[model samples]
Target: MDVKLTEEEKIKVLNSDDIYGIMQKILLRESKIDQNREHFWVIGLENNHRILFIELISLGTVNKTLAEPMEVFSFALQKRAVKIILCHNHPSGELRPSEGDKDITDKLIQVGIIVNTEVLDHLIISTKSYLSFADTGLLSELKKSTKYIPQYVLEERLKKQATEIANKKKTVEIAKEFKRNGVDNETIALSTGLSIEEVEKLRVRKR
Candidate 1:
């Protein structure tokens, strides 16, 4: 059977990776840390045939222990994503937005605009359901006073900080800790928002 694809259908198929679904799966696996983790969902939206379905770009996670926008948006930019829908699972299952979540969304929306992308929605998802900041009119308020930061500038600052951290570690044990835990230089670069060179320097010091 020959199937004729509508333009909208074509786009959906083209971007059928289902990033949100993947995020849901990841969150389910991380149930142990559900109460303290934040997940970022970055997606791209293409306007074709007057329909907008999200294209999966990348995913990042921030624990209550480490919430960093640099780590989040870096993946988005790497994916060349044109839009994003940020989501985090609330282990407590409370469908309310926290102050910190609001603040981060505000900053991300601003950054998105500066980077020529759109922050379409921020969702707080639980096992049972979800909340959409855009649908609730919260995003409209945030769009009014968004502060823009260039991606390159953010990356440069993160690189310097990572380098500093690497410089301070003066033990083979710390380096081995990174390697034994399956934390290679590339993983360290991603986790710390550092450059590969900096992570390599740390590895070299260990040897």
Candidate 2:
């Protein structure tokens, strides 16, 4: 558990223990905040598993913390992260996760799928020890419970889908315009990168 990282260094995370080692240093240095208060943090990771960023999403009282999926994933999206690791501290020094922990993890895993970012693991940390959902196989079990997804995540996913549909419609309209202008199917196909058959179909459909 080495506890040193330079500002420009990107740590490649191999497992849960790597995360726990990094967090250990953070807890040691962050003395301003009460060690007894719970804190929720998210580690953003690139496609290659290199660390992109670490962000503190929420802080709470002794036993509980509020970790919203929207808040968590917003940072991931902003950072262009392809995956994320969730970590939170329990001041009580109990490594066992609460029901709230499982529920939040389940919901975030669902949200992650919708957004194209994977939730690799969730960790519960104490001063002396830590618990890893992935290591214990709890993350696999949690992924099966897709009964609930956060409303915010659902709304954003719908918005993205709608935008994609609108863009495709606009592309079709442009192709139709080219057809109306007497552009040959071959020339239109070159301009729009559509196949000759596709351009012909578009022209026929517009009639």
Most TM-score-accurate candidate? 2
Query: What lDDT tens digits, residue by residue, belong to model 1 across residues 1-207?
Result: 112324433343122233334445545655465435554444444433222332222233443323456655665566565666666666567869887778888887877766776777777776666787877889898876525456686688689999876665543445446756767777766665556877676543332
Error of 1 at 97 (Å): 0.4
Return the clash pairs for model 2, or none.
Answer: none
| Residue lDDT tens for model 2, 83-111 | 99999998888898888899999989988
**Per-candidate RMSD, Å:** 20.0, 9.1
For lDDT, the strongest prediction is 2
Would you estimate the TM-scores of all the predictions?
A: 0.50, 0.68
> What ranges in model 2 sit over 4 Å off?
1-5, 149-207
* Pairs with steric clashes in candidate 1: none
Candidate 2 minimal-lDDT segment of 10 residues: 1-10
